[model samples]
Target: MAAVLLIESAMKFAIAVFSAAHAPSSRRALLFAQAALAGGHEIVRLFFYQDGVYNASDAVVTPQDETDLPKQWRTFITEQNLDGVVCIAAALRRGVLNTEEAGRYQRDAVAVSAPWELSGLGQLHDAVQDADRLICFGGA
Candidate 1:
């Protein structure tokens, strides 16, 4: 007889990626997120910091032959009903702003879209406290 081990509890994961959208690390992070979701793990939060904030920018345009990582992230997060947060400070510094943020800073336009919101570092701290596992990608 074959024995099957079943997990009674779902694992909660928090992902933090600090790489630019075009960097290999960013793609790896996305793949990890997808895998986690596929494996029935819950993604409590997806935090983007430093150059990773660029992943939330609506202004990102990829070459015809290249993959549009930002768009892929947006679609995945949206479809999975995941919380995607971009560090406000890092985003502002990098010119990636949501509508409210643009209004707050008096910017001409909003660069970020749905499924990805601008928030403070406190969100990351909260996710760390709540999640069973915190996976970080790329260097600071």
Candidate 2:
């Protein structure tokens, strides 16, 4: 029936995160993402904005007793082959840079790597246009 088809349909989600990796917001976002995927929903993209850029930074070191949310994010994104984008302006301001960005800015270090992309807001806009739902977490 149409109702059963509708109930079984999978949605495409765009997740926007605006908190640091150690923050509860980021953890909640991660859990939501996991649940969404497990429920057969597709993640169109993961957008990291403001402090959320820290979730994609390779330079972020977690305390020994704490969960490494950033690392977990990286692993999940890579394993899922998901598009994970970090806002370039926010990331640069927060000292999180990919190799290309580091080279462009003449920085000697790179704080971000593969599976995480440094891009502008356009990517988020595109994801919003393509996704059926836009879930946001941790913003002022």
Worst window of 10 by summed lDDT in candidate 2: 1-10
Instruction: Give the per-residue lDDT of model 1 (tens digit) for 111-131.
Output: 997888888999999999999
Model 2 bad stretches (over 4 Å): 1-7
The collision pairs in model 1 are: none
How far in Å is the alpha carbon of 84 misplaced in model 1? 0.3
TM-score between model 2 and native: 0.93
Question: What does the lDDT come to for candidate 1?
Answer: 0.91
Model 2: residue 19 alpha-carbon error in angstroms: 0.5
